[model samples]
Target: MLATYPIAATEQNWISATLLGALRISLETLQEGNAPPEFDEALSEEYREDFLRGPKFKKAYDLFIAKCRPLTVDQRAQVLTALNEQNNFPGVFTSTTPCCSIKDAFPDVHSAANELFKHAFEKLSEWKTPGCEQTIRAKYHQLVDAHLSHGSCPFCGYEPLEAADPDLVDPDLDHYLAVSIYPFAGVNLRNLTVMGDKCNRSYKGAQDILLDEHSARVDCFDPYGAEQVKLSLEGTRILSGPGEGPAWVIHFDPDIKSRNWRRVFKLETRLRANVLERHYKKWIEHFVSYAQRHGFDITSTDGAIDAVARFKETCEFDSYPAIGRLKTCFFELVEAALNDPMTVDRMRNFLVESA
Candidate 1:
């Protein structure tokens, strides 16, 4: 990931709190050998009547209880414990260290628990508070606005993330722990974050953040509290083989978190297709025009080098920098190209032509 977003101050509202409370009560009641009907009665006695009236909540609760009925007493206890731990968003997400896998966490009942939570998450849209006006979905948008107000998508630092507006569509609320696997954290605010469509759907769709395909633990950045990871293109070079003009190597910090982030988002491949290949020539053209307008003589290699350095400085220090890391690295690449005597004339020619 290119940047980290600020953790939202908003706490889970009555909807989430009530659902979690009900789930816990249901799990505890089942572990004690209580039947499904008794679990229903228990929820009715605890939560408000209006909140429990919805068919959505009823269906979710009924399905969850039915799924739990097949589990052994030991399995039930394990599921309950996993749910509680996963719900503690702070404990689960405060660091880059990998947590236990769902299979290990819940042992024999992970599949059943995953389905139950998936159904429950789907039903969250229909669960409502008696006196509260905003739905949980609306609160999700508010969280998006809170974090996105700082800048672009925190995952890639490439696309812009817009706040929720009536006239505009809201960004995707990506489940950091994908619901298909870690459904225990489906509705946890810390697990949900706004991501660009490409990053969420195209790249990281349902990929597990905590474990690799072989189910090994992998270090992952905490979207809310992680420090920004840096990228360096100094080692990147234009390819020499056939079909290689836009093809070049991409480099990121050689840290486990960075490697995990790259693998999860396919960052290097994306950077090549989306940024370097697509924008390199356009950026160079724009730079030449910018230099000409600023009275730089692009005809001279020294002048081109100076302009490239100045552009890199501007990008490095700009407020609300767009693709700041990639831009800085790109300018450095241009500067290096300018310094190469073999490439300098070609670079100068392109700059003069672009001007």
Candidate 2:
């Protein structure tokens, strides 16, 4: 969930044009639905002839326009807060709060506003629509570019792309602000995210993965912003007796923010695979090679663990195989053992014996 580059000029222009077209369509749509009592009293004969002629719908419609206006920045913090407060939109599209639903959130919603949201939500998904996919939704190559750019699944850095072909499109454009929950923002360029095929379909299927901050996860790092953290080993590790396999325990520091981000994509368990383990193992291989050339045992307990930890601080912080994410678990495992010289000696000797 890395931060994304800004929308290209052509893309922004297309989106603005499409939204303007949507506004025109929204006016016509409001003509279909009958005026609710909330604004009926304010309208006279000619004005009453249409749905948006009254203030109820017009107010909401105008607000919708303001929101859809080209969002120059990605965060939309102030705008979204205003939306939840002034617009009465609580982002309840997926509210687990019993009996709450999209329809319920906007019961007295005006037709113009409804149509505006409806148009963007419905049209954005339709490739042939004017501002959706510049060329064709099926052929929109950005999804492909996004997949290749990340080198791995954007959602889970461990999953690498094997090939790219028209018939075999594997990556998916995930709606970071889920379409079901926040329909109004469905087509917003900022809301769309490039994701791994499995992360989009199987692992994160129909579930909300957004934290207070999107693109906040490291593997899953925000490509748009910068961050810093000193990672630590934070879970129980079991020392093995002879013949037992090494135990891997990885849990990031306790923070609601990290948990929410991990929960959204199931990073904890899903990331526990050989793909990431291989990366962790490579670090040792690298140090061994470095030791051989330098005529020193980088793996020796004398200063090995601390040296690795220091190196990790310099190289692994906020990178991938990204740290404080899925791949660093093994390093933590090693760090745990290094804390006990007996365990370190046992493991180091064991590695030599096994080799």
Q: Which candidate leads the pack in TM-score? A: 1
> Which is the leading candidate under lDDT?
1
Candidate 1: stretches off by over 4 Å: 33-47, 88-133, 238-247, 316-322, 337-350
TM-score of every prediction relative to native: 0.80, 0.54
Clashing pairs in 1: none
Measured over all alpha carbons after superposition, the RMSD of each candidate to the real structure, in angstroms, is: 4.1, 10.7
Number of clashes in every candidate structure?
A: 0, 9
Whole-model lDDT per candidate = 0.67, 0.45
What lDDT score is found at residue 296 in candidate 1? 83
Candidate 1 lDDT, 1-355, residue by residue in tens: 5666556433544444656677788887777787645434645444557445566556656666776778788877777776776666655643543344457554445665565456556544555445646555665676556666655677776777776665677678788888766667776667777788988999889987777667666656777775667677766654334445634666666566677677788777777787777777777776877797888887998898888887778776433333556777877877887899887887677667666
Q: Give the Å error, residue 35, model 2.
A: 9.7
lDDT of 2 at 107: 30
Model 2 stretches with alpha carbons more than 4 Å out: 1-101, 104-150, 161-170, 209-232, 236-241, 274-295, 298-320, 323-342
